[model samples]
Target chain A: MEEWTVKVEQSDNKKEKPDTEQLEFGRSFTDHMFVMDYSEPVGWHDARIVPYQPLTIEPSAMAFHYGQSVFEGMKAYHAQNGDIQLFRPDKNLARLNHSNDRLCIPPIDEEFVLKAIKQLVYMDKEWIPKAEGTSLYIRPFIISTEPYLGVAPSHHYKLIVILSPVGAYYKEGINPVKIAVENHYVRAVKGGTGEAKTGGNYASSLKAQEVVGKQGYSQVLWLDGVEKKYIEEVGSMNVFFKINGEVVTPALNGSILSGITRDSVIEMLKYWDIPVSERRISMEELYQAYLDGQLEEAFGTGTAAVISPIGELAWEGKKIHVNEGEIGNVAKRLYDTMSGIQYGKVEDPFGWIVKVKEAAPVK
Target chain B: MEEWTVKVEQSDNKKEKPDTEQLEFGRSFTDHMFVMDYSEPVGWHDARIVPYQPLTIEPSAMAFHYGQSVFEGMKAYHAQNGDIQLFRPDKNLARLNHSNDRLCIPPIDEEFVLKAIKQLVYMDKEWIPKAEGTSLYIRPFIISTEPYLGVAPSHHYKLIVILSPVGAYYKEGINPVKIAVENHYVRAVKGGTGEAKTGGNYASSLKAQEVVGKQGYSQVLWLDGVEKKYIEEVGSMNVFFKINGEVVTPALNGSILSGITRDSVIEMLKYWDIPVSERRISMEELYQAYLDGQLEEAFGTGTAAVISPIGELAWEGKKIHVNEGEIGNVAKRLYDTMSGIQYGKVEDPFGWIVKVKEAAPVK
Candidate 1:
């Protein structure tokens, strides 16, 4: 691990913190943000914390035209006793590098960048909402900044980390969401950018989301791009199904995103002696299981919601109800345990929590 | 068509023009650019031609995070008698709207935007290169500019058009280049954003291009994402093959871009009474044609290259040479005729040329 010196510049005019109860996802930002530049020779340099403001970019910047960009999503929780904590931050940074490789962007020093993120979060500690189900969402993204219009990898890049205080994903407790099984559109396929947390994958998914959203579905459950039969994901989250007393998830084919919360849930299930399997689970098999009354529960896992319960699935004009349109016991327990460990209320047996220290006093 | 007002603001400090012969593709931009803003209720508004400069965008803009952006590439040629002409600019604008629909961006009025482009090009008439094969490259792009970070369609957007003086794609005569058939990576699937000229498709292609480039190939021929057997595109251009005196190209499947130059080539072939077909083309079928000595020629068509002849193809540990690694007769004739019509040296039979008049005297 390299010890990189990150320069700090406090903002002269700090923003008034937003009301925690009214906080929206990615709407309000903190006063300061961590910034870094990357170019050839000087791989990644000029690390500094400056005021969160608009970026002056050329209209021909490669990210705007070529979509050579990558991002990560995580959060900072205002834990008990005034401590600030991060859940599986290292995993998120590791996934960021994986996404960079897929997008052909240069890699970052994850450990050093994690330190900078902690510092930025600490600098804006007041922005971390302490209300229940509220925390500061951390978005670390990299964009190709070169002004040339050529269709090639950019030499210049910008890595930025911004903090946004967000309210709970579910305002009225952990409720289930209706998901439409996508048939006409695809999110990603094997050998595509689906496994990476890049902008294009999300961009490609908007149409399907919009279409299903208009049909009164809260989100969409994406099937495999090839067969369009096997389950892949549900609204940018890794999906799991409890069938016949066993939990099964769509194995990470090349196109499925490797989710951190998905990893945590599997580990937690293993620790609790719950039967879990990651394999190719086809829609036909799931439907057969439903017909046999073996379908027990369904849920999605991600950093935002931690665990999202799927109540109903509409596939090819047929609706399939899961767990009688209620949150399953496993989902409720997983969410409680995950949120408990995240907010420092439960024992972190896996050592996934990283703490941010308060600023040291000047000598 | 509704007539709209376009405001103009000339730059106080105009940049010195670069040497025509020393120009590179998309490196040197013109002095001015056209821009328009789109928002809900207001729709597409504030069309203006302003000085070419950097854009001040929020760090959290949706374009940077989700890659909801689309762009079109065409050119303005400096004709033989100092007239500036555009080749099938209407096709490019129509395709731009198609891309907008796929990316969930607001659509632009093609007629209004084309008029704005002509006005901007007329304003920067001196920047159009006069060298033999050089011209002004026009890039019209739309980006989601909302500062919010939700994974949905953006309500705010920016439509911008910039001009860059580009040299000839081939410094010497139009020569053939080696291409590698990409096997491991996929560009797009049938239900994906492949047909749309969005950033994600290009971003997904960089890795395959980089891998093949290291193997001494200039470009990679993309296969269908689902089966990886059918040919989709070559580099960023639409590919065509002449087999047994008939030209065949991949049909407009949902996963292949609909190129304007490609359309021109098909129409020109039809006009010449040469056999041409747009259908699903498999690499195996092409290989069989080569084996039977029936493969006549292969070429790619796009705005940048106009016509790129394929000399050799390396696929699955086998190398197949086309036309003895030389430029084919049809490719040469197409390039000559296309460039001739674009530069105003030949007859325009298909009504493809749209001339930009000289700016009227300000009275």
Candidate 2:
């Protein structure tokens, strides 16, 4: 494995850290960040951890003009004993490479990149807030840096990792939110880049999101692009529903992101011997289930929120309240168990958590 | 209209202009450029023409991570009488607003932006190459400048216009080329950003482009995203077919970009009293037409090449030669007439040409 050079910031900015109680998602940054570059034939080189600063990229870089970029989001939890732990970061790096494959970007050594992420997190370990539900959000992304304006994959790329101290996703703590079922705008189709965590998918979703937000909904529930019948995903999260004691989610049908948290929820349910399934569930069936009082719960899972319970779903001018517009037992259990393992409070039988080692102070 | 501030470069770089014969598209830039800013409430402000320089954007800018960017392509022509002109630049600005609407970006005043474009183009008129079939390509793009990583429309944006003196799109003049019909990857779908001239749509096409490029094809003919059966577009251009005696191009479905060049071709065909139809045409129907010897010509139209004749098509291992692997009479006439009007060699009776006036030196 190649070693990553560490250049600690000469003027540390940790003293300007915001009060953890009022932190928002992805707003503030840590003192240091990790960066690497890749060029043709040279492979990925210049791996280093440097001070957090604005990047000087060419105006005509492919990333700005062609949208040739992908990013991964994960978090580092601060345990009660001051240990920093990451939940399933290996899966995130693996998914990043998977996204790169679909986007025609060069793949990085997953193990080596993960090590670099850990080192960067360790260097800025003090930024990990000790408050409950607070963690250091890590965003790792690759952007095309080639200073040309053509509709092709860039010849040069830069991989950057930045750390942000984020507070709890729900200010009031895990309250159920309403969502609007989007019928006009489509997110991804079978042959599209939906399965890949690329920027285009999210960029295409802003219109629907804005419309739904204006209607007082917290998120938009995206349907399959082809028929617009089958459920695809919710916002940027993988969705799940508890119908008649069975937990189900839309299958990874090449149009939904293979979320790590979604996978963990399935695993946790299966471990507890609860009935679980991965298959296509249409909105009609879900509404019917709700009408019959069999729709127990509906929620979204992602790294940022961990669990976002869906209270009411507005579909075609009709509303279906899930679990009495309140958090369901299944969602609460999953969120607690998942976050428990992440915070080192619960026993991790799946070998998911990777602890970070503290780094020595720089000269 | 408000007059834009002009900030000419103190150090002239006219001596560094590349030889027009060896010029590559979008590689070398001109001496000056145009810029404008958009923010909440203030709308678009600070319109100015400034020297071409690298932009200093934050690494966490929403444009870099979420692909909140849109761009337009047009060209400035040097007339035989030393007059500089633009061909239907109003149409480009109109299309730019259309794209901005789809991406949830704030729209600019079309007439005002057009004035800015003309002022900037006239200031750098020396960069308009005098070589045959050569013109100065103008790229006006808007990028989100908000320093955040959320998946939402940005409140702050910057519109930048850069000029590049480009040679003929085809190195050896316009010639018919071979294309492969892509069956796997999709470009865009109904209710997607395909209709917008945005970066994401172009970014998603690079993978398929790379694959076909390896198969010795110049471009990949894109199929509809949902069914992957009906023809959508070829590369970045709108496609056309001359069957028997009539000209036909795909109708502007939601998933197809309404290309300015494509519209011009249709207008020209109608002006010449040629039978033209804008409707959906499937590849199967095209193949059937080829089998019956009714497919007389095939070509693609866009700003970059204006007209790209398709001499050969390889689909599912079957190769069909278009017009005996030669440019058809219609394709030749269209290319000649288009270039003729652009170069001021033909009378533009359609009132499509807009002349540019010389700009005074900056104070």
Candidate 3:
């Protein structure tokens, strides 16, 4: 006898035409989802495809009391071959486990989650829109659901994979964005959860987002917590700037999230033979260089927005316009090349694509 | 017509009394609990006393995905008048709302939660063991249950209050505990969720706890993230040290949590005519003072353990014994007075007690 059993959920058989135009990024999810449970007695069990519904758990589950949770976001692009494909999901799975170890949540079999994602994507593949820059965004998460609220590791956890149909990241179509250079309020600090793909880092960014949004900025350009001088990632994305025709970004400082899109840009830039450097780039350096006409382009990279070319940076009530308020040559090339590989328009030399099978409507 | 509705669950006839000595800290819950739900159509509704049972939620709830949750802990003590009383619940309510504003969860009416907690305590009054240094612990938590894996705030949330009979915090009773002075890893940081009673800060401390737990310490004596020089807080408590016979604590830096018990100690000490001060005390200064025999005693204060003294501090292969490895005079006086007030053995001068009416046992 097995330790756990899958109680498969019967779908409601409600298939409406998905309206791609009126969609906010993460508000609309696909119909079906995948789930698995982890226990001390049983590592991972009850893997199943289920109709998307609310779950039943104890009120004192560790997730609510202790925040023993981790998550990852990746997009399933509607390829030219009429199939949705995931971009390097294994990287996400590996990072998820890394965060799990940090929170002391049980480790997940990386390959199993990949297999489950494949199944769920096939089940709700219609949710994948075909318009340019549109894709089915996938969210994979693990949470400790143990009932006890002790200040220690939980014994039980749940892992779930959900899909959402999303429109173009730059919904108004690739226009340059303004960012606020935040001197205070570090999103993640050294020796903290900065490197983990956990909820706290995102939660830490909400206040900064509200502040920057009120100032008409797209996001907050985080600075190092120690000195508040060195450049870091934006609220939810990695930042890059074009200096002297060379691509430069803040190196992996153990205090910034390792973005998948950040890695992709570096790879494509190297493939194009463009000079790329990752080092401790400072805010003063970028601002001063922009004043001296050395800073050509600046953009942010993340799962939501592939590459958002920054138009202006608001600092201490002064706006620093980049490239005369226009998208530079480097931002466009990086965005187009990365999106091409993701959408199957260009050859995937790194073989990042994971083919999603066809959708099967419920009976 | 009301802000919240009640779910009145009467206690069962069969109530088994557990051995008070064997009761674990947070594992045993009482018979009844209070809960309220939040939705867009209805702001906050369905508040009531419900049977202590497992809760049902969506696996993709915002609390699980983005850590959009907050919790408060307090104890209900049974007094000599056969009446149950609660400590400064108003403070918990205000702090909860402050946390709610940051997480974007709607704040339920404070009166409703107060009444709900009263009803829960009345129903499960028997679970309040008469043993010394023990009481019925109440955990009030709010979690965003929106059934989607988005990083943004949740539209749906649930506020829940549960009662659990907890044993003595210290096994041998009031004995000083050993701690590790952490030079790395931060509990809270500037402009982060440290000041808010958020789960993210607790989650960030999980790995630190694990690493320090291996080094033969109960908790980490955390330092400031930016500098790792100033003392911040202990695992789940606020630190107070006696320097040259003066009670000193870390100031309300934007980093340390505003603990209710920490406030109570400050007020009580001031009332007792003790030289109380809330200032930024550094670890280096603390160690130097300890060496000079000016550091009389150090104690941690919180809702769980009213006051626990510290015997030793280990850091970077240096082990420093505090107050000659014993509970010092200052720690004893504060712990005795606070515990006396909490247990209703002393005069209630500050009007901190909110008495509860006990329910008759089921026939």
Candidate 4:
């Protein structure tokens, strides 16, 4: 692997950190950020860590007009033992490449970018919240920066990594939320950019999310675009249902995002000797299971909310309560174990955590 | 209707005009642009015509991350008698609002934005190329500018209008191009953002275009995302077929883009007393018509290439030639009439031309 050097320019004036208790998701950011440029001749070069600020880009930049952008979400935990750690950073970087392939973007050296991210997080170590369930959310994204209006892949690109300290998803506890099954709007189709963490997939989903959000639904459960029958995803997360003591999730189809947290949950379940199968499970089957009282649990997995339990599903003007509209044992255990492992309070049986070395304070 | 005011800022230094014959599509921008801001309390405000330049936007802007952006494409022609005219500008603006609806973007006043565009185009009137088939391409786009990462609609937005001097899509005469039927890599599903002139739909199409481009095909004929049977679009344009004397196009099924040029063609056909209909036309049906020697012509209609004739189609290892692999009479006549009306050489019976009053040169 080629060794990549990232030049650091520390900001002289540091902004005051936000109160950990009042930290909002993606609202506040650290003082510094990592950036890299990609062009035709230079594949990916000019890596630097500079003061977080606005980007001077052309109004006709392809990313703004064509939506040729992809992003990944992860977190840095301020461990109980004063060590900063990353949960499955490698997995996130690998998935970034997968998204790049699907979005027609040039790939980056995963190991080098990971090193740059670790260095950026270390320099902003003080910004990491120490409160319970508080962590620094890391968002790594790529945008096509070519100042052209033609509809094609961009020649120039910008890869950016920014950090934000966020409070726990559920301030009270591991509570379940209601989800509305979407029938009119579709998130993705099999041959589309659904599996890729591209901007368009998320953009296409905002309308449906907005519509359901008005009806007191926390999120939307998307069905397959082709059939509108087979289950696809719940909001932006991978969804799973525990029916008759067996866990089932939609397979890693082309239209479904291959979520890191979803993979971790599957691994953990396998470790616990829980029977889990990945296949095409239709909404009709799930509804039948609910009718038969075999639907024990339903949950979603993602980086932000590790395990979001679905308490109620409203489909076609009918509502069905899962596990009496409460978090099931499987969901509770998964959330606790995932958060525990992330915060270094549990044994690292899977070696998923990558410890960050302390860096000298920026002057 | 409330009349909107537009503030103007001229550029201190004027850029040298590109050679009319050497002008490229969307590569060289005009001297000035129109911009407007949208926020919660202030709807769409700060409407201004400013010097064309780069935008200093936050790296975490919602448009770059979520693709919540929509745009419109039209042209300002340097007419035969020295008048600048826009063809169906109102239709383009109306469609822009329709796209805004699907992408969850706040709507802009069509009349106000159209007035702003005319003024901006007049201010930079000298940039419009006088060469045959050349014109100033006007791009009006709205981007989500809120600096947040959470998945939702943006609270802040910037609607911008930029102009570029584009050479003729066909440097030579209106010639036909070969197209490949895409069996994989769906463009947009019926329930997806296919109908919206948004960034994601274009972004999702690059891979398919690239693959077909490598095989010496000009564009890909996209099938319906649900069935992959019915024709949806040809490249980014709405497609049409001439079968045994009748012109047929896919109906405005939620997934197919409602193109202004497509509308114009249908109108032109009706005015010329030719049979025209909007209905779902499957690839198999087209092939059967070709087998029966009834498929006379195939063409695509859009703002870029007002009429793009498809000479041949390659599908599943089989190839079919249309009109003996030549441009058909219907496509030729439509192109001539449309471009003629646009350039003010032909009579505008439909009152589609909006003439721009001359503005004082930038001082």
Stretches of candidate 3 above 4 Å error? A1-17, A357-363, B1-17, B358-363
User: Which 10 residues in a row give candidate 2 chain B its minimum summed lDDT?
Assistant: B1-10
Per residue, candidate 4 scores C-alpha lDDT tens digits across A1-363 of 123678899999999999888889998899999999999876898888999999999989999889899999999999889989999999999999998988789998898899899999999999999999999999999999998999999999999999999998889987789999999999999999999999999989989999999999999999999989999999999999999999999998899999999999999999999999999999999999999999999999999999999999999988889998789999899999999999999888999999999654321
Error of 3 at A262 (Å): 0.2
The true-versus-predicted C-alpha distance at residue B314 of model 3, in Å, is: 0.4
Candidate 3 DockQ score?
A: 0.63
Top-DockQ candidate index? 1
List runs of model 4 lying over 4 Å from the truth.
A1-3, A359-363, B1-3, B359-363
**lDDT at B217 for candidate 3?**
90
lDDT of 3 by residue, B186-292 (tens): 78788777888888888889888988899789999999988898998988899999889799999998888899989988998888888999888888898888778
lDDT of 2 at B24: 86
Model 3: CAPRI class? medium
lDDT of 2 at B125: 81
* Stretches of model 2 off by over 4 angstroms after superposition: A1-15, A359-363, B1-15, B359-363
Docking class of 1: high
**For residues A105-196, what per-residue lDDT tens digits would candidate 3 score against the true structure?**
87887876787687677767778898888898888888888888788888988888887888887777688888898976878788888889
Docking class of 4: high
Q: Go through the candidates in order and give each one's DockQ.
A: 0.88, 0.75, 0.63, 0.86
